[model samples]
Target: MMTGGLSETKSATPEIQDMVDEVKPQFEKKSNEKYDTFEAIEYKTQVVAGIIYYVKVHLGGDQYVHLKILKPLPHTGEPVELLDYQTGKTKDDEVTYF
Candidate 1:
């Protein structure tokens, strides 16, 4: 019934920013650990039929993540490896965390 009330006036930007800031360090540390633990991984992907692409994540240690890479409709470019850490699995289409 009430539109743009006091509740709506209170912004979530700062709360989100603070939350991100608080967790950023922890996330960074964990990400660094993942990077350090897996250094011999490789990734491959190719765009097909517009925005969908076949993605292969080879985590080298012994695990992999395979998924259909897609962005929101009406974007551009195939799925590119923004951040890839591959482990060069012997078999194909399997992802494991080591």
Candidate 2:
């Protein structure tokens, strides 16, 4: 993949699901909405100083949210952080850099 460019979007995997779980609380807090169902639908990744993940998540039916999460380089011992997010998204919305 090209440096600093987002990778092609891929369907969510188990690893990606775990990452979503890790940051779900932060997302709920930021959005001020508790989701009864949170599932990762797809995602794209950009290589930076660390890694930026742009994920499309399903919040039950007809509801979705896009999350921007940062995973610091392992050597730095930094926690994965929920950087920002966009609410009121839909299944057709493409997950892109924000």
Candidate 3:
């Protein structure tokens, strides 16, 4: 994959799902909505100074959200950050760099 370009979207693996779980609370806080069911469905990755994960999440039923999370380089000793997100997405929505 290109260094600065987004990787092809892929189904969420166990690792990806764990990453989502780590940031779920932050997402809920930012969106001001608690999702009873938060599931990571698919994702795209980009490599910068760190890794940027663009994840498509299922919030049960027809509801969905896109999350942009940053996992700093391991040596930075930084925590993964919930950078931005878009709500009202759907199962059919493509997970992009936004």
Name the top lDDT candidate: 2
Candidate 2 on 1-98: residue-level lDDT in tens? 99899999999999999999999999989888899899999999999989999999999989999999999999999999999999889999999989
Against the unseen true structure, what C-alpha lDDT does each candidate score?
A: 0.32, 0.95, 0.94
lDDT, candidate 2, at 59 = 98
Ranking of candidates on lDDT, top first: 2, 3, 1
Residue 91, candidate 1: alpha-carbon lDDT: 41
lDDT for each residue of candidate 3 in 1-98, tens digit (9 for 90 to 100)? 88999999999999998999999999989888898899999999999999999999999999999999999999999988999999989899999888
Task: Go through the candidates in order and give the C-alpha RMSD of each one to the true structure.
Answer: 17.6, 0.7, 0.6
lDDT of 2: 0.95
Model 3 lDDT on a 0 to 1 scale = 0.94
Candidate closer to the true structure by TM-score (higher is better), 1 or 3: 3
Worst 10 residues of 3 by lDDT: 27-36
Give per-residue CA lDDT, model 1, range 1-98, as digits (tens): 12211111112244333333343334336446342222212222233333222233333456543323333234555332222223233544343221
In model 2, which regions exceed 4 Å deviation? none
Clash numbers, per candidate: 12, 0, 0
The TM-scores, one per candidate, come to 0.28, 0.97, 0.97
